[model samples]
Each structure stands twice: as C-alpha cells, then as structure tokens.
Target: MSHAPTHVTCSAVSFDWPDGTPVFDGFHWAVGPGRTGLIGLNGCGKSTLLKLVAGELSPGEGQISVAGTLGYLPQNVTLDTGARVDEVLGIRTTRAALHAIEAGEATEANFAAVGDDWDVEERALATLDQLGLARIGLDRTVGELSGGECVLLRLAALLLARPDVLLLDEPTNNLDLRARHRLYAAVESWNGVMVLVSHDRELLERVDQIADLRDGEVRWYGGNFTDYEAMLAAEQEAAERMVRVAEGDVERQKRELAEAHLKLARRKRYGQKMFENKREPKIVMGARKRAAQESAGKHRIMHTEKLAEARERLDQAVEAVRDDAEIRIELPATQVHPGRRVLTLTDLHLAHGARVEGEWEVRGPERIALVGGNGSGKTTLLRTIAGLLPPASGEAVTHVPTRFLPQRLDVLDDGRTVAENVARFAPHASNNVIRARLAHFLFRGARADRAAGTLSGGERFRAALAALLLAEPAPQLLMLDEPTNNLDLASARQLTGALESYEGALLVASHDVPFLESIGITRWLLLDGTLRPTTAQEVRESRWDG
Candidate 1:
C-alpha cells in the first residue's frame, strides 16, 4: 500500500537514561504523513521514540527532522486542575484579546493577539464537540472533568492546534467505550502525520501502518495491527523452520567430527602397530608416523572448524525466533464449588453516588465483567467489594477468600523482590514453593529476585498478578480494576492465559472489551447511576451520554 510523503525523519538517533539504562542506540526511522501505530513489548522504547520525535526528548547522537509543527499527548496527562478549559487549550490569551476587541477596545495589541483567530471560541468549542466534549464548556475548570474526559480534552487541544504531526501515547487507556469510539473517529479522520502508541486493539485497527520497535530498532509493517501480526507470524514460522535446519546441520557436523576422531584413533593405532612390528627401517617408520600424525591433525582441525561454523549458524537461527514467554499457571485451589455463594451486595451505595439497589449476589465460579464510562464508579464498586473502601450506605460481603488487584498495581512492595512479595501474600507457602509458583508467572530464578521497583511495566504487572493469585487460602473470588489498562499486547495475552487457568469467581472492572471476552465473562454489568445487567454487544455499542 502507498503511504503519504515523509514528514518526520530520525537518523542514527541514540539515547540513554540518566541512570545508564540504554534505550535506543543508532535507531533510524522515517515516518510519513499517515497514521502509524507504534507498538512493542512494554519498555521497548516505543514511548521514548515518540517523545524524541515530538521533541520532548533530544537524541544523544545523530539528528531528527520534522517538516511541520508537532503536538504530543503523553501517556500520562497532567493538567492544572485550577486552570480553565480555554487556558489548557492554549487559547486563553487569544480569546481574551478577541473579547476585548468585541467590547469596542480595538487596541493594536489586542488585534495582534487575536490575529487571524477571530472565531477562536467557536473553533475551540467545535474541537471539543468533535472529541465528544461538547458538554465541557470552555469556562469549566479541569478539576470538574473525569479522567477519561480530561484525556479527550487534551486531545481536543491538540486537534485545535492543527499540527502537522501528532503523537499520542496510550490515548485510549482510560477511555470508556464511547470515549474510545470518539477517539477512534478523531484518529481515523486525522490527515497529518500521526504516530500512536497504544495497546488498545480497536484503536490500532484504524492505523495505516505499524511501526514495531524492538531491541533499539524499528521494523515497518504496511497496514494495521492485524496485518502486523500476520506478517510477524509468518516471519516467526520461517525463523523456526530455519532453526530446525540449523540444528540438524550442527548435529551432522558433530557426528562428522566424532567420526574423524575415531578414524584418527584407528590410524594412530595401526601406525603404532607397524612401528612395534619393525617392518621397515626406523627412519621410514618415523617418517610414516609423522605423516600420519600431520594428516590426522589436519583432518581434526577441518571437522572442528565445520562444527564451530554450524554451531554459530544454529545460534543465529535461534536468535531470530521470538521468545515471548507465557504465564502457565494452575489455580485448582482457587476453584469454588458450582453451587457456592461467593459474594453478595445489599443496597450497595458507592462513595461517588453510584448504587446497586436491592439484592445482588455472585455465585459459583461466575466470571462477571463490570464496565461503564469514566466516573461511573466501577473502581469505587470494586474497592468496596474488596473491603478497601466502605460503601456510602450499604454493605458488600465476600463469602469466599478474596483478593483485589487495583489498576495501579500497588499490591507489591517496591523494596521487596518478586518472591518476597508473593511470600507476603502466601505466607503459608515455602520459599521454594513461592519461587516455583512465580516461575509460572514468568519470573524464574534470578528474575524472581529482582526488586519490584526495578521491573518493567509488564514485569510489574505479572509480579502483582502472581502475588494476588498465589495468596494464602487461594482466593476463590478475585476482583480486578482495569487490570489491563497499561499492559502491552503480550502481557495482556499472558494475563488472559493466567485467568483462563483460574477456576474461581472473577469480577473484573475494565473497559477492555476484548480482554473481558477473552476471559470468558459470563455476565456484564454496566455501572451508570446504578448497576444494571447488560451485554457485551450493548457495552460496545453504547456511547458516553455525558
């Protein structure tokens, strides 16, 4: 597929963190005027690359060039709560100037400030409306908006800038289904050079191409995430086949080398016998012995060189094969009987004015998905159920042993190792058991000894998940709040595999429809003003009414 002309270029760029953690070294990439989905395993420098291109970060070596204006929406957006929407949109001064001129104060400075943006307010409102933020007036304070709304509001500001290049990192992270759709539409309509770093599958489906960042280099794939996956799968298949062929070559070389050694031993023994028999003059025997030794040494050297070359080829072939280790855990102890009652709620009134009236019960090993728009109290409800938060006017009780994995993944102690953290949760399990269990979570041997604070995003998630699942008494009811929020595709898939092995009750609060579906959610509850039973289709189809 053809792409737009090149708009951004990075030539032999190199960067390293202050702590000496090497990120990218001599990385080169050229992005054109079309949507490019930047993807990789967590901590592979996808976000760092975007930051470099956006000029938030400077490369240590080489150069980067952008053809036009640039705008960047970071993964974590921090806005001054006290600031007005217009101020955050960067039009506060312009709007003030326009208002002054409209009030009959047509000063030279006012005209200069207003410049050509005579309809600044209209344009700002239009941009906000386009991002499903029409309800958020320009005069409103940032504190008044929900997390997801604030994300969209930031995007709106970028849209209003009319930048030539746009960078968005995890743009759909906290967004609800409706907000995601709005963001998707905005992304789909973008005509500039757009680079989006996200784990959201649906958002990635709209991109023109995929830029896969791995091992400090970028590989371009024409088309979206699905296309990238297809291409990667094919590549991996070929690499695996080459590995097998290389392995066979190495074995054959080893056999040939062994056979050469055997032949040399036999020749040496025959020469020794001839010398012992004294069948020729001493000089002749000595000369024949030297010749045989010389020939045997040459033969051994040739076979050894061939074996070394074959081994090197095998190593290269193995390196080409990706080793994305998966979590393979068994949670038979977490299983609840088919007829057991796991949790119950009565007149559940959350802290944020959201409620679940009357009686609510979760029985057996039911997997329920709690989904809603931002500020709909999904987290609040989950916290209340986990006993971390007190309900405003009701009670939520879990009959079975339970554990909650919050979105922040704060379950782990930063100072503790993975094994120690898991031990904290599973006090009854021995160190060996804990270490063995952690292996299933992909934290093996030395990896389990790494401090929680030192882990990458995906590693931290896996560690936290292992701690929660391996807790003492084997939590029969697991509550998770936006568990997949910042997870990479591979990490997300690992979580799915781990969850599939869990035979307990699951109440997951998430906006990730694909993840919820993957975990085999048996029930869907939409948390608006009240908790109401819903379906996945409705959740996907529903738009944010706020």
Candidate 2:
C-alpha cells in the first residue's frame, strides 16, 4: 500500500515577547514520522516553539506550514472544576453541538427537536474506557481528581483526536513511577509523528532523535539524553581548544603592539631633542632617525594586527555554556539539627478496599529514594508524608520542619502575581527584601509583577521555589516530588547543583536516574503495597528507561 507523505515545515520562524524582545531568532526545524524529542534547558524556548506547532500562538516573523491536522497535550490543563472526566474528553459535547448545527438548532424549530443529548456520551465513555480510564470517574468533579488523574484524562482526549502530528509537552510531570511507565508504553505504540519535551532521560531514550536546545540554539543527535550529553562534551572540548589557540594569537599581537609604541616614542624623543649639524653628530643623527622610523613603522603595523586577533579570540570564547547556569538563590541552608528520630512509620496502611498494608519508618539524614513502575505509590508516599493523604492505619511521625515541592508546584496560587504570592507566604519580609529575593530567582523587575498565570512553565517553577524560600526560617527537611518533570537539562542541573550543597535533609521521588545518582542517594526504597529497602541487585539494574 502506497501512502501519501506529510510534513510540518517551519521556515525561518521567529517569536518575540510582548515588549518585542526576541525569544526565538530565525529558529527553524521540521517534524516527520516516529518519535522526536525536543530537548532544552529551562527558558530555551521549547514551550514557546511547541505553542507555535499547536497553533495556540503565532510567530513574530517567518512562516510555519503544516500539511495535516495537529494534536497536543499542554503541560497544564485548565479544568472547569465542575466538569466530569468523560465530559472533558471533547467527544461528549462535540456530538451534541454537531447534531444541533446539522438540525439547524440556531433556528428555533430544531432547538426543541434536539432534546437530551446522550448519543455521543456513550461512545466517548467507551473510547475513554478502552484506554484504561474506566474508573476515572466520568461524573466526579475535575477539582476532586488527583493531578495524575487530570493528566491521564487529557491524554485520552488527545489520543481520540488522532491528528497527523502529536505535540506532547512534559506528559510525565506529577506522575508516579507506574504512571510514567504506562505513558512510555503508550507513546511507543503511537502510529503518528510525535515531538515531545521531557527531562525524564529514561523516557527520551525511547525516541528516535534528541534535539537539544541551549543558549538560544538547537542541536540534534541520534540517541537519548545521555548520548546527547556525550556529544555536547566532545564539541565543547573542541571549541575550547580553538579558543585556546586564538588566545595565544591575541596575546602575541598585544606584545608586538606595545613594543612598536615604545620604539616610536623613543625615536620621537631623540628627534625632538635633535642637535643636528653639530659636526660629526649631524651624520649619526640622520642615520639614527632613518633606522628609528623603519622600526617604529614595523611595530605600528604589528600592533594593528594584534588588535584584530583579540577580537577574533573573544568571538570564539562565546560558545561556552558555562554562563547559562541560572538560579542564583541562596537556598535555605541545609545544615540543621533535627531531633534524633525525624520520622517513624509503624505499619501504615492505605486502604484500596483491602486489609492493613504499607508499613515503614524513616529517620535522621536518610537520603532515601522511592522508586517503582508507573502507577506505583511513589508520589502517594510523598503525599502521605506531606499530610495531604491519611494513612489507613499505623502512624507517620516527623520531628523536623518540613517542606514539600510537589510535581506540579500546585502549592502556588495561579491567580496571584509573583510578588503577591511571595508577600502572602512571606509576609514578614519587607517589600524591598521580597523583591530582591524574587529577583535572585530570575523573576526580575516587571516580570515579577505579572500574574503567575502569565508566566511560562520555567518561570512558574522558579516563582514557586522562590515563594518556598521566602519563609523566615527555611524548612529543615525538604521533599521533592518529580522536581525534574517539566525542567530542561540545564535548569535541572542548576537546581541539582544548589540542592547538593544544601544543608537540609532531602527525600526525592523521581525517574531521572542519572540525576538521582549524582545527588548520592544513601539508600533506595521500592514502593509496592508497602515501603521496603531495595536490594543491591535492583540498584545495579536501575537505569534510565529505554
């Protein structure tokens, strides 16, 4: 069977901020069949580019041409709160609206004829059920379901659309271990072109190509995040060597220029005090003047050449990514004196219509990692610790001041401006102090005054963390639930670098194996119905999912 070919062509595409500051400068890339992962560190414009592909936002200049339909899953969905899961799937109401239009419901006669619209609801419900969203509460309010559930609900709708090209932005954020695995499985079987952005290295390894974004440019490779990192390192090494050679040339020129100036000055001083025509001295003076002029001219030419060499060297030095490391916040000091027994859980149980289960006790600077497949209880464990969910039995104990940064940072107020949110949580802080604190997180000036709703994914995340740090005495115990979800590699490294030197104890639940390992986790706890220490064998085999 011969099938037609289609493509998404973006030529010389560019976008700008409201103030006309360029976000993308003549950026261009294309998409085709199989899995294509869009890689970038925070603020590199991945989300904005994705918006262009989704047709939610237009470009400032250049043309973007798509030959077929598009399907997208945004990083976050704005739910009506009162809407049911099936109703949110698009199909439920789509049918009634189409039927009404077909019957000319705009005309008073057909409006009465199209009574009780139940026909499409059944089919929508069936489509959702087929994707394992059977018990997703077709009637439950959107506000009642968990973050993971909302993401899954949105996934169902996108799947039903079946567009020629699919754009998924951080689909694994806020998801537990088991939930992440399920997402990968679904993507692996997808029959259309996919362009995704995720920090989950394990997830990216499954894609066909990895396109990394850094310092406002995109570079693509044939493998996963790890593979891309290796290539990046090699390229940087070569660039550095070139810079070193350029520096040598620059220095040589500077020295020659200085010598020329000195010679020219000496000759001028001698000539200025010339006592020519003093018998034999007149002939000697003439010879000296002639030689000095030649020497001075040669030096002058060398100096000019040196200046040009320096400029070339500076240009070569600009390729280094070292300056892009953002996040300058003075993270709350980690060094704390927590009580001997920080936390102890004596046989806690989470009832899913069964007997007692889930039991464990964690205490003292135990850098523990909770790992499991998607749908496993990683985030649930984090939540239970956060006190959002109650244990069915037993008890959870903690003796230190704790703070939890959820996968979605839902702790922040979406409707509030960055400053307002900071002021609300850190009311004791003076206006000047609060602004300075937010500035360190890169919210800077007018951007900090903008409502949280208007910020990009990276900006929202930075604001959320800034709010947490504003408390007078920072929390001594830190809990992070998939903190790397929507963060690009550069942002993730900036965050991880800060956390490594932090003085507080940390309990992390993440699928970024490389990052987790870098932080030097002291132990691993795999979540089943209960929490238990992982075996050495399991640790050896743990890798970014492929």
Candidate 3:
C-alpha cells in the first residue's frame, strides 16, 4: 500500500554524553506517516534518538526536522500528584472557559480560551476511556492513580493533543494486560507519523516497520516484530554462510601462499646448485639467478596480497554476524525433589487488601507465574513470599532457601565489580571459582572486573542474575518481580535461557506473557484481590475475570 510521505528527518546527526561518551555519529534517518518501532540493545541509543526527534535533547552536529507538531510520552512518567487530570490533559483552561460561558459570563477571554475545542472535555474523557482509564475522571488527582494509570494519563494527554508526530518510549512498561490491549488498539488506530521505543513485543507487533538502531546506525526492516525476526534470521543465516565462504577463501589463500613459498625455495635451491656446479657461464648463471629471484619475489608478493584481501573479506563477513550471547550457567545445588515443599502460604493477607483465602503450597521445581492488573499487589505478594515483607495476617513460609530479584535490581552493590558481587553471594566459593562461573553468564575477564554501576542495563541484569543463582547455600526457590521490565529483547532471551538452566522452583511476577511462557511456567496464578489458579490461555484471552 502507498504510505504517507516522510514527515521526520535527521540529517548527519551526532550526539555525545556530557562525559564524552559518544552515541551517534553522522546518523541519518527519515520516518514517514506510519508506526515505526525503534528497537535495539539497551545502550544502543534508541531512547536517545527519540529524545532528539522530540526536541528534548539537541544534537551536537546535525538537524532534526519534523513537518508538524510533536507529542512525546517519555519512558518515565512523572506527574505532579496534586495536579488534576484535566490540567494534566491540557484542557483545564478550556473546561473552565466553557463552564464560565455556561454561567452567563460571555467574555472575549473565555471565548478565546474555549477557541475551537467546545468538546474538549468529551474528547479528553473519550481518550482516557480508550486507554482503559474510564474509571479515572478528569477531576481526579494524579496521586489517586496507580503507576500504570499515570502512564495512561500521560498517553491520554498526548492523544487528546493529537499531534502530527507522536513518540512513545516503553509505553507498556507499567501497563497491565487490559490496559496494554487498550494501548495496542490506540496504536493500531494511530494514523499520524509515529515512532515507538519499546521492548514490549505485542506493542511492536502493531508497528508498520522496525527501525533497528545498532553500532551507530539505523537499519530499517519492513514489518512488525515477527517479520523483523524472520528477516533478521534470514540475514544472519546468509551472513554466516558468507563467513564460512570467506573463511574457506582465507584458508585457500594461505595454502596457495605456502605452496608459492615452497616452489620459490625449491627453485632457489636448484639455481644455487647449478651455480655451484658451474652448469652455465658465470654471467648467464648470475642473470638467471637474478631473474629467478625477482620472479619468486613477485610471486610471493602476489600471493601475500591475495591472502590479505581474503582476510579483509573474512573480517567484513564476521562483522555482519551479530554477537547476541546467551547466559548459560549450572545450578545443581538449586535442584529440588519432586515432592519437596518449596513454599507455603496459609490464609495469607498481604498489604493492599490482597489475600489467599486458603492454604497454598509450591512443590518441587514448579515454575509459577503471578500475574494481575497494575496495583493488584503482585510485587507485594512476591516480596512477602521472599520474607522481605511480613503479611498483614497469616504466614508465608519457605521450606527451602530463597532469593528474590526485585524489579529495581538492587541486589548488586554498585561500587563492587561483577565478580565481587557474585563473590558476595557465593562467599564460600573461591575468587577463581567465582570468576570462572561468571564467565558462563557472559561476564568474562575484564567484564567480570568492571564495576556493577558502570555496566549497561543488559550487562547489569546478567550480573544480578549470576549473583542470585550463584549464592552460597543455593536458592531452591527463586522469586522475581517484573524481571524483564527494562530489559531489551536479547537480554530477555538471555534471561529465559538462564532460567532454563535453573533447577529450582520459580515464582515470577510479570506482565510479559511471552517471556513467562518461554521460561516454562508450569502454572499461572492471578493475583487480583486474591491469588487464584489460572491458565496461560486464560491469561492471554483475558478470560480470568469472573
């Protein structure tokens, strides 16, 4: 289908952090009137590019041009809790003007304030309703809303403004399934030029194209996330094939060079023998020797050049192959017998009015996914189960050792190196053993020595996971709260892989359905007002509400 004309353009854009860390150098891209998913590794500058386009950050050396007005929903939505919804939605003045006019105050100022938006309140409410915020009225304060609701409120403001260019950064990060569906619908219905930076696979599936930002450049893929994966897989396959071909060429060139050396040596030896035997006149023999030497030198140089060219080709081919390393570590001590009781919750009443009416028990290596709407106390439940928080009533008992990886990822000490953090967890293990085990988590040598605070989002996640899994006593019951919250696609996959090697019981509170399924969650628990058993299909279909 014919698409809208390009509305956003970046020309030779270059950006650098204040500390001299360079992000983009001469980056250029043009986005048309269609949903574009900007994705990459955590530190590949996807969010930075969005900030540049939205005028939140200035480029060091280039121009960012947009054809029309822009609206941006940043990844972190921080609103004044005291502010009313209408004020946040940019309609408080208009609403006041309408109310004043209705009260017979027909002033020019009120008329001007109302301007062309006579239906401003209706539109604002409609936008909020579309974003699953119908329960939240325009008169409500931001403080009354949950974190996910605040994100939707910000989105509602953007939608109400109806800017020509829209940018959303990790829009679904705090949203639940129902709210995410509403956001997905809104994205599907969006017609203006849009760019989204998110790790939410479902949200990305609604985009028209994928903009993969990597290694200081943007590569466009034509389609949604699944299509991008297909194309990327094909490209990687071809790249691998080219690498093999280039490697073979290099080997062949080496062999040819070796043969040339042997031939030249043999010829030189034969020439020397002839010279020694005086087979020909001294002058003729000298001329022959010189010619032979020159020929051999030319032959050697020709082979050397070919070898260098082959090596260059191999290097280029290798560059084309992506290096998305997976986390692979063994935790034999984390294993539990099938009949082992890992955890039990009896008549639990958690903070925020969430409870388990009856006895609940986790046995063996059961992978349970705790899911619910935002503000439904999933995190609270996990914290209580992890012994970090006490339940308001009843008890949560862990029969085995437990480790909790919170959403904040505060398990590691920022001042310490990755190896040091692991050592803190595995205190009984030797320094060499700690470093050796950390290598399986993709933190090798110097990486293991780097401070946790200096690591990127993905690297920090791997380090935290390594520390959690490598503890001294070995946690037989592992609890994670929104583990994939800010992780990139690759990092999420690495987490899944790492969990596959985990032999303990898993309790994960997350909104990431794809990730939960990939980790082989054996059971699904909906933590609404109470914890109840559910299925993956029921969760995905939103049929759990009764």
Per-model TM against the reference: 0.92, 0.76, 0.92
Better of 1 and 2 by TM-score: 1
- Candidate 1, TM-score vs. the true structure? 0.92
lDDT of prediction 2:
0.72
Which candidate would rank higher by TM-score, 2 or 3? 3
lDDT of 1: 0.89
Residue lDDT tens for model 2, 1-546:
014465677888888877455788787787777788898757678888888978999998889877667788888766788887657876545565646777666755444443444455665566566555567646667877667767877887777666778888989876655556667887888777788888777788889888777666777798766787788788888778777877777787787778778768876976867744354477787787788788777768767966796867667675563455466666545455544566666666654311124445455666777665445567766777778888677766766777788877887787888999989877888988998988777778987888777676766777777776666567667788877777776677767666765666788887666777877788887765556678434744654111
lDDT of each: 0.89, 0.72, 0.90
Clashes per candidate, residues 3 or more apart or on different chains = 0, 11, 0
What TM-score does candidate 3 reach? 0.92
lDDT of 3: 0.90
Q: Model 3 off-target regions past 4 Å?
A: 1-6, 104-109, 412-437, 444-457
Worst 10 residues of 1 by lDDT: 1-10
- Can you write out model 3's per-residue Cα lDDT over 81-151, one digit (the tens) per residue? 99999999999999999999999999999999999889998888889889878888989999988888999
Q: What TM-score should be assigned to candidate 2?
A: 0.76
Clashing pairs in 1: none
C-alpha lDDT of residue 453 in model 3: 76
